[model samples]
Target: MGEKLKLYGFNNLTKALSFNIYDVCYAKTAREQKDYIDYIDEQYNAERLTGILTTLTDMIGATVLNIARQDYEPQGASVTLLIAEDSMLPRSQTQLAHLDKSHVTVHTYPEYHPETCIATFRVDIDVATCGEITPLSTLDYLIGSFDSDIITMDYRVRGFTRDVNGKKLFLDHPVTSIQDYINPEILRRYDAVDINVYAASLFHTRMMIKEPDLQNYLFKTDIYELPPLTRLEIMNNLRREMIEIFNGRNIY
Candidate 1:
C-alpha cells in the first residue's frame, strides 16, 4: 500500500458493506423441509455466528468493544458486534457515544415453499467501519463462511474527512466495483453483475452460481436414489428459484 493519507485530525469516513446470501436446496417432503430448517438453525446458531464475527473483527484490525447475539424461537439467528479501530483510545479512556460508528451484524432467515418442495436459507450481514479500517477486507471470508448460491452486495462510503491541507476528502480509497475485492477462484464459480454510482461512491454487485450440480442441491437425499426424470425436475425447479432470486422477480 502507498503512504497513508495525512489526515488533519481523525479519519471520519464511514465505509459499509452489506451482503445478502442465499442457499437453496431441494427437500422432497414437508418433514425434510423442517429438518433442513432445524439443521440450518443448529449450524449457524448465535454462538457460531458470534465466532464468525469475532474472526472478521480481527481480520479488519478492529477491537471488539461489545457484542449482542440471539437465536430466534422458531428459526434464525442474529449477531451484532461493536468495534473500534486499533488506533483508537483504550476502553477505559474511550467514551461510549461512538459505539455505533463502527459495527458488524448478521441475521439469518430460513424458509420453504410447501408446493415447490424448495427450501432457501438467507443470511444478511452488514459491516460498517469508521477511521482507517475497510470492510472490503473481509469479503472473501464472509462468502466462504456460508453456502452461497445467490449473493447480492452493496458497498458505500459516506461522510468526509479533512487532510493536512484542510481540504475535505469524501473518499480516501478507490473502489470501482465490489467484485474487485472478491477472490478470483470464487469469481469463476459465479456469474456476476455490477451497478455502481461512481459520483455517489456507491457500488452494488449480484452473483448467481454458474453451474448447478444436482447432488449439491439435494438435502438429506441421495442423488443415486432418485430416478432420472425426478432428478431433472428437481434441477429445473432449483434453477428457476435461483433465477427468480437473482432477478428479484417471479417467473410466471
Candidate 2:
C-alpha cells in the first residue's frame, strides 16, 4: 500500500460521481415505441437494478447498510442503497436500522418522442461517498452496465480533510478528468470531451459512441430489409438523436 496519509482524524472529504447514459432506438410506429418501452422496463426492473447496485457496492469495497427499491407505474424502476466504508463499521452492526451519508441510487426513464417515432432509455446514477471510498474506481463498471450510446458524467470532491500537521486538503486524489478512469478500449469506441474546473475540484466528461452501426439502433427491424434510401433516413435520425443528447441541445 502507498504511504498512508497521517490525518488529524477521520477523513471528512466527500467525493460524488453522477453518471447519466442514454440508449436510443427508432421504433418506426407507435406500437413499436410502446413495445420498446415495455421491453426496456422489463429488462431493467427493480430486482435487476438492486442486483446491479449490490454488485457495485461490492466492487467499491463498501458495505450496504440499507436498501430501498421500487417499481413505478407505467414504466420505471428505482433503487437506493445506503453504504458505508468497508472497515468503518462492524459487519454485525451494519443493518437497515443504521443510516449514513454515503449512498448509491439509480433511476431509469424509458421515453418516446411524441411525433418522431424515436425512443430512448436513460439511466441516471449518483454515488456519494465520504471518508476514504472514491467513486471514480467504478467508472468503467457503470459505463459497461448500460447500453451507453451517449454518456455524461460529473465528478467532484467536496469538503476538507486535515493532515497531521493541521494542513487542509480539499481533494485527496488527483483527477484530470473522469475519462482517465475509463478503460482505453472503451475510450477508443467513443468520442469524448472534458470540461473541468480544477480549482473547484470538479470534472465533467461527455461521450458519444463513434461510428455506431446503424443496425444497432433499430428496434424489431432488420437493416437488410430496408432500401438504401430508407436505411440512410433511419441512420440520419439516429445520429441526430445521439448528437442532440450528447450535446444537450436540439438540431434542425
Candidate 3:
C-alpha cells in the first residue's frame, strides 16, 4: 500500500544528529548472558524489557543490570535511539517497523554480542536529511536492560498515523513510569560500559533516519536517573500501573 519506515543503529542515529556513539546498547546484565538484555536502557522501552533483564540477572547470580549500563564510561551508557514514521502504516508504535526476519540472523548456541543493534536502514524524509538505524539489534536493549539503569540516551523519533483515530487516542495513557512521576535519580557516576547485544527481531530488517531539521523534529535526547525512587518503588508502581492500565504488558 505504501513505502516502509526505517530504523538505524546508534551510529547512524547519532551521525544524523551530527554526533557519534563510540559504542551503544549497554545493558546491566552478566558478561556471560550479556546477549540477553542489551537494548534495555533509559532510551527505549519495549513490552517486557526489565523482566528479561531480571531473568538474566537471576541466571547470572549476584549480577546487576545497572552495572552493565555504564560499566565503561564517565558519562555512562553512551547510546541514542532514532525512530521514523509515515510509512505503509500509521504513526503508532505498532505501525512502526520492528526487527524482522529478512534483516538478520542470530545463532544462540555459540555466543552473543549485545554491543550493537541488529539491522540498519537508510531513510530519507522530505528534503531535510538522511538517517539510519538498526531496527533489528535495538530490541536487545528493550529486552535486555530492563532493571538496569542507563544514565544517558538521545533519540530522534518520527511517527505517522494510518488512521486519524490511532494518532488521536489509540496511544493515549493516563499514567507514567514511576521514574516519570517520582524521585528519579539519573547516573551520578560511570565506569566501564559492557555491551551485550542481540537482534531486535527476526523480521524488522532495515530502517532509516530523516535529515537536518527533520532529524531535530523526529529525534530526541533524554537522560535517566537512578536511586531515590528506589527500584522497589519503581517496580511496585510499574506493577500497579500495569495491572490497572497496561493489561498484560511488563512495562506500563
Candidate 4:
C-alpha cells in the first residue's frame, strides 16, 4: 500500500467515472446485420461481462459484496456489482455495513440502420466509489476490453474529506484529465481531446480511432471483393459514421 493520509475520520469523498464505447461495422444485408447483432450478444453476454467486472473489482482493490446480472430479450445485457472498500470484511457483513455504496455497472445497446446496412454496438459503464478507491485507475483496462472504435469518458470528484488538521480536501488524488490514465501506446492509435474544469473537479475526454483499417470495419465481407468505386463508398460511409458519433450529432 502507498503512504496513508491522516484523516479526521473515514474519507467521504466520492469519485465517479463514466465510460462510453462504440464499435462500428458495415453489413450489406439484413441477414448479415442480424448475424452481427447475434455476434455482439454472444461476445458480450452477461457471463462474460460479469467476469470482466470481477476482474475490475480486483484491480481497484475492492471486494464484491453482491452481484445482480441479466440478459435482456431481443438483445443487450447488464451487470452490476456492489463493492466495499475493505477487502478483508466478511462478504455477508460488508453488505450490511454499507461502508461505501461503491458499484460497477455495464449496459449494452446494439442497433442497425434500416436502409444503410450500418451497424453499431455501444457499451456504457459507470464505476463509482467513495473513500480511497479511484475509478481512474481502471480506465485503460476498460478501454482495452472492448472493440473501442470511439470512446467518451467523464470523471468527477465530489464531496469533501477532512484531514487530521481539520483542513477539508475536496479531492484526495490529483487528476487533470482522463487521458492521463490511458496508456501512451493506446493513445497513439487514436485522436484524443480533453475538456476539464479544474475548479469544479470535472474531467472529460473523447477519443476516435485514427486511420481505421477498412477491412476491420466490414462484417461478412472483404473490401477487395468490391469494385474500386464501391470500396471507396464503403470507406467513406464508415468514417462518416465514426465522425458523427464522435461529434455526438448526425451528418446530413
**Candidate 3 vs. truth: CA RMSD?**
20.8
Per-residue lDDT of 1-252 in model 2, one digit per residue for the tens? 245555554466888999999999999888899999999999999999999999998988889999999999899999999998743443344311212369999999999995777899999999998876788888888888889999999998888876657798887676788888999999999999999999999999999999989888889999899999999988888888899888998876
For model 4, what is the alpha-carbon lDDT of residue 119?
97
Lowest summed lDDT across 10 adjacent residues in model 1 is found at: 91-100
* Residue-wise C-alpha lDDT for candidate 3, range 1-252, written one tens digit per residue: 124333222111211111111112212235423332232222222213233434432331222313211122111122111223222333445444322111111111112233321111111111111122222123233323322211212122232122223322211112111122112122112221222112211111111111112111111221234354543353443234323221224443
lDDT of each: 0.89, 0.86, 0.23, 0.87
Candidate 4, 1-252: lDDT as tens digits:
257665565467888999999999998888999999999999999999999999999999989999999999899999999988862324333321223769999999999995766999999999999877888888889988999999999999888877667798898777777888999999999999999999999999999999898899889887788899998888888898899999889874
Model 1 TM: 0.93
Alpha-carbon error at 117 in model 4, in Å?
1.7
Using Cα atoms with residue i matched to residue i, what is each candidate's TM-score against the true structure?
0.93, 0.92, 0.17, 0.92
